[model samples]
Target: MATDSLPSAFTLFESIQPGPVYRIPSLLYLNSHQVFLAFAEKRTSSSDVDAKILVLRRGKFQDGSVEWDETVELSTAVKSGYRSMNPCPVYERLKQVVYLFFNCVEDGVNECSQVLWGRNAARLCYVTSQDAGLTWGQVTDLTESVIGEQVQHWGTFSVSPGHGIQRACGTLIVPAYAYIIRYRCCLIPPGFFTKPRTFYLYSEDGGERWSVGEPLSRCGTGESEMAEIAVSYGNRVLYCNARAVAGPLSCRRPSRVEAVSLEPGRFEIVHPARQLPESDSGCQGSVLSFSCPASDQFSWLLYTHPVGSGKDRWWRHCRNRTNLAVYLNRRPLEQRHWEGPWVVQSGPSGYSDLAYLDQASTFACLHECGDRQPNERIDFRLFSIDDVLRNIEQRGRGVATSLKHRQ
Candidate 1:
């Protein structure tokens, strides 16, 4: 079937604010028919920046519409003195709790870069909401528990942590990188570059406290950003990451996504692995969630920007265009190949978050779009799986009939 003919896009939701909003993250819960959008609102004053979490509930109306309502605010001035970004929340079915986790920064600087230096105390914290997202309990420090005895040097190790959801066993795994500073020629002080080890932490008691796990993988890659980790049917844990390229000023690297087995305190990489298309630039892909209806069966959906081979390769420069792709398998934890990267929506120049709702019948994405470019206003778009499947089927039939006639 022609890839372009497939239903490549859907209208999940739209921008809510007049200005541009960025760093938006979304979570969808199928059992409860609920969707949550969390992001940081940028203000002219750094202190005015606040982290906002919005809840959208699927209504019973026949029109196939959803209603969004603001539930709680984790404002910098109100809740915590630091600015919150990268909000990641996971729902615990057994405990009936939703744990909302976010990255907190004191000065509101992008920790990914080394220009701005701060304390190593930056963290990924959480707050729980029992009744969906209507109300939130007191904020809890999940970072402290994650980084138990890990020493922070020059306030770099504790910055820019990544997290994932292990839905099968209801475990929330957070991965953090250890960083070291090196002095640049012109730059006043040295910048922070990720070290070799990757640390993981999990919450078995519903985000109240996290137990630290040993490093999963180690490599010569300057900085390895943890994206997603899932337990496959074979009882192996897959770890995905974006590796940093070697160079003084080069931020590009061969994007490496690997899978590993989950042992007591460590893991090993899986072979016959799934890899990105050659078109992808060295940018790392973010795994949204692993959905499995039956035991030991699942699919891992990831979002990444497409790029070509070379240093200046820009594939379809839809600036900051976010692409959706998936890898499915029926076997146990054995390695498999990735299928999609079915493009959903692009136009805005920023990161987009996706969630599956209503038993995967509905898919929603929340991202930044506006006149301000990159970080502007936050908007959401929803699409029905049924509609997408119908389109795919129609496209498939067209391909089949054409092939038969040609023969």
Candidate 2:
């Protein structure tokens, strides 16, 4: 218990009144240059409609500490009535270029209207940077290029608001979800239910040419992130995990949607005997697949989310956002469950982005934390793999344990 005083998590931005508020953290680590980039949405309020601009910070490690430069606001030149949402993938090392993929929508266009009326005011837009995020190139429109004939049928679309990944074969992939509305008889679908699915956008010629992959699931999947995984026998697979929603008049249960793809965009969704629990918060969670040299395996999947259970699973806003936990699994294709949660944050926590500092043998997370609310400021927590699996023994038995009982 005495070791609890040691620092495992720290704050990057503190909350203040009548000033800037930050949310939606995105972290990118450039291993070649040992640089870290953090991106977030600088909002006027905690509401979804208050997101005005995307802000970024650049930093480098020195003596086991990272010092960040001055905060820079990444401006979007959309029309006065449009706003940018979900800034993702700030580091593109393949072509020696950086990209920020997000969606621009007209102001006052909410999700309910778009979902109910089958109308979308959103456009897939992006910007590039050659020399890091110091200067951004002109914005490009990807809505018509990636989604040509299906553009109209897409009720609305947005990125996952996290770091995107590049496949081994020189393909830039960004995870996203859109509403696929079909008009049968009235304004809403049959029995007031709607269709939503997860998809990915890929670029082959380094942002010169782009195309959209097929939907990952049939419907009801949204806000997904994809990570490339390597097997022991020199085989690679793409894994996508999405947030599952069970609305009223819907028989679907609350769970996490999981799937895999050997070919980009062509996924075989896994329907296991049991379903992964959706975080009590119901917000987006972060997952990263990385190789573990210490462990005698190819790689492991690391995930972060708020862990808890409540009586009412319909609405998550009323649930406590405490006990932000991290889980690890080696054989994702065969295993039905992951290991210990290793409770990291015991207080109000929200959407987080993680970066594996391999050389330092630690990982970093940028998340939302506060005393009474989760929107006060986005925090950066530093931890190691051993700390995550403190006293849990591994015999290939499927059970998730935790170190601290703070939750």
Which candidate should be chosen as best, given lDDT against the real structure?
A: 2
| lDDT of candidate 2 over 1-407, digit per residue (tens) | 10122236556666578877888888888777777788888777777777787788888866677888878888653446777778788455676787888878878787767777667888888888777666887778887877877867777788878889877677788888888865545644532445788888887777788778888655677787778888765688888878766555544346677788888667876542133566422567788887765663477888877665334354543365665667787677765767755566666777888888877777888888777877888887777776656622341122333333333
List, residue by residue over 327-381, the lDDT tens digit for candidate 1: 2232324445444334443333344555656454565555544443435444555
Q: Stretches of candidate 2 above 4 Å error?
A: 1-7, 76-79, 186-193, 249-253, 272-275, 279-281, 294-297, 309-318, 391-407
True lDDT of residue 90, candidate 2: 42
The CA lDDT of each predicted structure is 0.45, 0.72
Q: How displaced is residue 157 in candidate 2, in Å?
A: 0.6
TM-score of 1: 0.68
> Number of backbone collisions per candidate, in order?
16, 0
